[model samples]
Target: MESLIAAVREQDEAARFLVWPGDFDLDRGDHVEEVHLASGATLEGFAGDGAGGTYFFCGEGGEERPILYADSEGGAAPVAIGLPELLRLLLVVPWWRDCQAFTAEESRELAAEYLEDMPDLPARRDRAAAALGIDLPAQADVLARLREVAVRMGEDFVLVLTPEGHPYEPLFTN
Candidate 1:
């Protein structure tokens, strides 16, 4: 399964790709949406660049999840698609002006840290922005946008709780 995702990522020529398994089958939209809702997220499609060929849609549970068939070809393997990188690609790319440039781990750490400290979603987002060194007044919108991206990325954003009920880390691995 990892190999398959690796193959996709190894291509490295896709302009944009989504990692949602539910987005693949139009019929399963509701099911995926239900799962997303249960996880406190909503599923929606975001536009991607026309270049770089295809958009890879990796589904839940790593390579076991259905990979979306794209009109074009080329992209990182599903497994290789780092959560932070994926979030940056999906959420930040659209808001290029307010987004910060950071590696996947940095993004994940910042987002997690902000969420942990702030607890409140809005406040957490503000901290996220500050952590990223952004001063956009529209931080609320960015938070909402990031939430949508998190839901879309599913397992990647599933926070694991410690014995004391604190978010210890993301549940899934890339």
Candidate 2:
């Protein structure tokens, strides 16, 4: 298991210390719904007319998925409607690191850094091709395929593609 997963599984103290500020609406976008906790505690997050806040969830891989939502009358701690809905909620949010999940702001920052560090998407693609010792044309083709994969599976899961239109298998044998 990845170290992050291990840390969460062990229930590290840091896990509890992390907090995402948001109004957790348990209603699944409904007008009237009841929200409670495992311990049956009545939970209210952000309350009042025209209030705004955020709620946080732990992702399947132990990453924090923080989401911000607002309601005219405020919100409450999100109740798990079901397994699938809970899973969907997990995908819509970003992976948290340390005390906070990557907010929309953070994603922009990271994307900017990545673009600045590379400065050339096509060149980076070419270099990736060269690192795999593939020809330029084949590399371009594979990159196109990867781009498609990135579009389709983005956030739902992580994917890596090869020049042959196959998923890139990490080098784990060495």
Candidate 3:
């Protein structure tokens, strides 16, 4: 299969949509700080958000490797096990950063705000998903999976500040 990064580069609308609501840019893969995984696994900066946040592929592998998100604020979490899952989260819930609670009610409120800003979020997301050949799951499912991945599956994938030898704080609390 062709790499999702390659696909994103080739698909204009997919890349555009990801840039807008997703706040994701393939060109901004550079993380601002020096960091490493506690397990000493290979951490590759693959993508980034508008802020100085980085999306890293943990361990040695292709896009199938676990993904860790580290924000400039020094918080980190394992958002997804793979690139596909991470993209699904971005596509379904662009306001994921605002969703500290990660509840259906909170998501609904954030969705409403986003809808007000970009009423065509669903259509745009659908086109992006189609372009990327990704089958997006329901918003609830995506959020639930995010919670599980960041909260449950994240303990083993701790991000450490290489400079100070201190572990980054967990982004997701519940």
Candidate 4:
């Protein structure tokens, strides 16, 4: 997780857009640690938060971590895998879901472009969807909605989480 964070920090685009929670001293039992304790899932790192909830990347380590979204309701759902995949989804899914910015064909093309070089992307996507207890079709629907929400809110917008799973809106410029 530390390595991933470092890599992200080095990238101007990712660092600029993917807000990190470590910036604020929120008394929320440590976001990654708490989630690890609660679910027995090892925290690889955190992605960001949204109106939907706080999102995290968890796994033992390596190139395939499952992205999870946890909310104030004490519920968590796996959304995607790997930092790259999650970022791609964040960029394209919402636009696809809204159906206002891109057509289905365009959405697929965009997703493909963003997901280029990802080996076995379909399988990874399926694993994430299954972890969330969603079927294939439903998974697609959720991604669309998730994408819509994330993009409309702003690429850099992230809500910091309290130890109790409550979210605090953090001010983000650009």
Best by lDDT: 3
Better of 2 and 3 by lDDT: 3
Regions more than 4 Å wrong, model 3? none
Better of 1 and 4 by TM-score: 4
User: In order, what lDDT does every prediction score?
Assistant: 0.31, 0.29, 0.92, 0.43
Q: List the residue pairs that clash in candidate 2.
A: 22-53, 22-54, 22-55, 23-53, 23-54
Task: Candidate 4: list runs displaced more than 4 Å.
Answer: 1-4, 20-29, 36-39, 50-52, 94-174
Ranking by TM-score: 3, 4, 1, 2
Model 4, 1-174: lDDT tens digits are 455445544554434333321111111223443444244446544443433345655647664665555554444444455555555554335333223333456566655754675544555544443433334443355455444444443222233343565433322111
Error of 3 at 14 (Å): 0.5
In model 3, how many backbone clashes occur? 0
TM-score of each: 0.21, 0.17, 0.98, 0.40
Q: Could you tell me the lDDT of residue 106 within candidate 3?
A: 93
TM-score of candidate 1 on Cα atoms, chains taken together? 0.21
What residue pairs clash in candidate 3, if any at all?
none
Model 2, backbone clash pairs (residues 3+ apart or across chains), number: 5
lDDT per residue for candidate 1 within 1-174, as digits (tens), equals 234333334432221122221012222222111112123332222222333222234434432232221122211112113333333333333322122332344445554654575355444333443443334433344444444443345444332222333332321222
